[model samples]
Target: MTGERRRLRFRRFATRLERALDGGGAVRRRRRPGVCAALDRCGLSAYYVPAEYGGELTDYTELHQALRMVARRDPGVALAHGRTFHAVAPVWVSDDAVAAHRVGRLVVGGTRIASSLAVPGMGPEPHTGVSAYPVVGGYRVDGEEWVGDDLAPGSYVSLLSRTSPVATPRAHSLLLLRPDSLPGRGGPSGSRRLAFCDTRVGADALVGGEGRGAEIVLKARQLGWAAGSALPLGAAEHALRERLAGSRPPQTRRFAEAYADLLLCEALSLVAVRSVHLLPGELSVTSAVVGLLVPELTGAAALAEDAHLCREVLAAQFRSLVRGHRSPHDHRPQLDRLFGAAEAVVPFAPERIGLFSRHGSAVLGTLPLSVRRLRHLARAAPEFGVAAGHAERLLEVTDTLHQRLPGPAVTGDPGLGRGYALCFAGAVCAGLWLGGGPAVGDGPDGLWRDGLWLEACLTRVLAHLGVRPPSGADGALFDRLATVMIRQYEDGRPFSLLPFPMAEGEPR
Candidate 1:
């Protein structure tokens, strides 16, 4: 499914999603039951379960359609929903399978909803009955954690603590508690009072084992992350399609670069989503290894790709249209934020750049010398925003790993060269998300051009790497993809590629 055919097929789904989104179906989940019951008529409930469980599940193509539709309404909402979509995995892994089955039955019955598990501080806290420890039977489960707004009545809540068991001390375990177990125990008497604001649910509470809470939490977060990661990709795709459909051809290269990002993210999401079904423990931990490496790799690429897209859009139309119309009149202060949006990204975001390189080196380093050789060198690459001196220092460590390891070596003359290409692919996708736009038939132009343009650039950049072909038709696919993205970039309406403003008064 590459090139024009892929686009043709997807375009229809995207259009369908757009209609659903515009019809307010995008956020039907959080609304009143009657509203959602209407959406269910549209057959969206199929999206809620695994294919094995009578749901269409997260089919890459379908997800792309669904998310693009929802995101056009609100990226934040799409993000929030995505994070909670697969909220069932942690419970499925419960040591107390009986309880897991009970919870499953509730969900199947539409009488329940569940928030994902998260390290306590990572998520909001609730008012009452949080268990205290791996207490009498389980770890002390005395505490309260908030069920995010996405949670409806009868929805389950998950939390994580930093306890380690004596058996597998190196790793963490899981615990499950249901909504019924409220006010199970209060904090210290003198400490403080736990209050419930608008908190209401049934009573037979409890989920996983007490001490194993952390495991479920981590799994939930990963599930959430995988789901969240897909959104930007979908949105980026939507943006590219919308931009390319317009009259003008893009003058810049960023659109294509962003497209590459969309493609890469879709692939990563496919893999990450599959990783969700794994039983807990070693394989799950390995999946985490994949999780840590993903964002940093593709996330960086996405940012870079989007930055380029924004640059293209702003340069072409935004500077004149958006800036000219608003800047001169300058009546509404809010409009100013749009132009100022493209503030510079500081030299290499070390956290961003180092993520893949460091994580890959940490996990993959244990492999054969040949594998380690090529893999480690990537962490050391110089980033656009990174300081050269520091990048150089980092390079030293990477260099040592590359040089010391000896295994599969690309011959100097071997057509394919050496570099961290996968990570680079990840960066390309991330770049598209930030600046991409709406899907076609959804409405007017979106930042789609930027996605397409960025897609073009990423392809060009990746092409420079040794063209070691991918498994199947993927080789020809990337090649053709590069062309599509470039075309999209060359032919779309422009917008400023501004990073989302973190606070009020900041650029948009």
Candidate 2:
């Protein structure tokens, strides 16, 4: 990183985090909405827009830093900003039209609510956009998307449709419209379907073109993946600071590993960002999605527990602030649920990671853990061995890697903390898998080694959690990951050699 870049990062932090130091009593309590809006008005909302569109032209690093800063002070704001970023992503990836139609629309705030695939129980549809849809002119939109979240009530919405679905619609279309526009027909409609946890925000509108909605939405979700890393990364950082500030407690090992979780989050976050640009092959989207969701609580619980352990430490006010800031799942603002959203997205959430590590060994499903497979398994063969066999394979491969790999160095590595967290995070994934959550879904493609780092981290983290890899879960998880790595990296050939890494003194 350059000196200027470092300073710029600090400046960005200062700009977004001015709220942290404003008042007293856990800055989360008694927030000043006016301050938040003012900051957004000042340029916070346009952080990712290009210079031509009146944004800071913020790069990936700045966006990451800004998310951390905002999340650190108030995750609520961070989440809201995330939604906006998602709202605008279509423009960023909207081919040529991205600049003129979609990007230009958000630059001046012409739309209202933004809903991506996360919108209540939605699923992905195969690509279906025509280069020139509906042959008419301008933009015409139809169909209704479910709306929830606080933005629902009476907010306008920005939707993306497969351009080809409606001819005359331009490619990479971005549609901007109002909820009221659905006068029983035309120009995009709405329905009461999935409810988003983040519902505090007010109002909704539209952005860019209509008809060509899906492309914009897809681009946004893709770009939004990088930002997704920010959510848990910030939580992990705060957890570490909270634990370090406490008087040593019984949870020391878990605390330290949790501290490491933040580093892993950052490393993984960077990798995810690169994946956005580099476009890795054989990528598993849901696997990637769940990968980010799982480690969130590994760091979160460590922070919450340590804070409760030493509530007297006045310096650890962020803990209280964290408690005060409403999460995506907080049904009531006053009785806010801690790490609610983070918890829902993954199984074995909160202290479940530690609990499961102790007794419950997780086994993931092999028949693709998508909505379709889940439904099929649930309805057809409820007693299928989908989870157990997969679990055994993971454990087998993991042990092989441990035997083959060099002993991990324990000194002077900048990412040492990350190394530790990956072990636990991996273990946590295993636990989640046992609980019917799928982990390590990427089938032999695109930096599986990075995922291995996470699994390796889980091994160490499980020990810190006082978990003995109960029964056969540990061994099973190992085999699955090792087999995955070999099959993915070894050119899809059967492994004549054992699935192991190179030992320090072993001949190649």
Candidate 3:
């Protein structure tokens, strides 16, 4: 599907899915069959499969947008439906004709695939998740894989197991297994708590080649992290649409800041997704930027809402933020590794390789528009004196950060990675504002020109850098955002990159 077609199709699906789950009742309940049928009918399942395999996933941008749409309505359905692609990504990159063809057939046939990549004994240790012993025709597999209820009849799992005696992280290989084909020791196959015991597979089941598990896992994770940002983006929209419906001062401020934060994240995700296509080599750093900033943005939005609502708001946001993982901390180790890698890969002087510097024209093409943005923002600064010169100062910092980059030879410091990502986000946001780009979805006025939201965004970077905000900065910015947010909510629209129109008589 073309970009416009994907958006139109997914929007149609989201509308129907929302109505079905809402059931015209006060409480909205999600049923697997209803969700699957809706999605299947719309050919959403094809997004998971590659085009050559009869699916429509041409790039990460489409996947991100599609997942964001589902995530806005039902997180559980989004994750369950999307995780299969996470597992299949490694296979897709492997370029193994046979394996790709097989997976493609299953995906086109509407069969769900699960992953057993992260099993017990998976660390760099003597213990291995599953061992592949040499046999006549192929390697016999022996181990256990714990998984949730994602598996069922006709479903398969992509398993990573130890194939060589080295017993190291790099010594393993990947296998796409059929659970029913293996003899199960115990546990219900249909239950979410099922653990496959003594699972075995032949040589042809191997994903690409022997001892490629470590490399494959890393690539797959990068793809997953890049796509994962959609969940938070959608969740933020969900929370804003549901919780901020009043015209009161506090509610209005929270809504404005929330919307600004959403823009930063939305831009960050788009840049990262495009990088995968335009600069796959830099994905190591770009994906890390996405992984770290997404959680940061989600938490920030939740915090803003928490200040206005009760603990329930925070709890719901938390659940939406960390729904598919083992725990919130699950992303920490991966984050650390990615960050460490980023310091080496991220150019301090990004003009040579920066997305905004090189690719900004593709997204925002008018210099006149950019100048108007700066003027509008400049005009609004008088009202919130606390953020005076902050936007310009941030632009200056962006230049300095790029010039100061120590080059790719130095080992990356995780702390430096955080600062770099913030600097990158600030640069992109400021540049877009300067160009007077339109908001994700709004009227002729460039949304970023709102003095209040820009100040809030600049203040956030300053706070992160340990700079104290001017007196009344907090209160002034909050009140400013609150007004905008309230107006948007009253209009009955989602605070999204491209805002969705609400149905007639849709419940708030």
Number of the top TM-score candidate: 3
- lDDT tens readout by residue for model 1, 1-508: 3345544544554444444444543343444444344334444444544444444443333443455345434455455444335455555444455655565555444543445223322122211234343334334443454444344534454444334334332233343344444453321122122323333332223456435454444444444444445555534544555565552655333444445545444444533443232211112222333343334334434323222222221122211222222233323222111111122111111111110111122112211222233234334542211112222333343344244223243222112211332332333233223212222211122223323333333343344342322344234434444465453334431122221111111000
Error of 3 at 199 (Å): 3.7
Instruction: Give the per-residue lDDT digits (tens) of candidate 3, residues 18-91.
Output: 56445544223546556765666666677777677667766666677777766666656666677777778777
Give the per-residue lDDT of model 2 (tens digit) for 363-444: 1111122223334443565432333333333444434332322334422232322222233234334333222123223222
Better of 1 and 2 by lDDT: 2
Best by lDDT: 3
Q: How much is 240 displaced in model 2, in angstroms?
A: 5.6
What is candidate 3's local distance difference test score? Answer: 0.56
On lDDT, the stronger of 1 and 3 is: 3
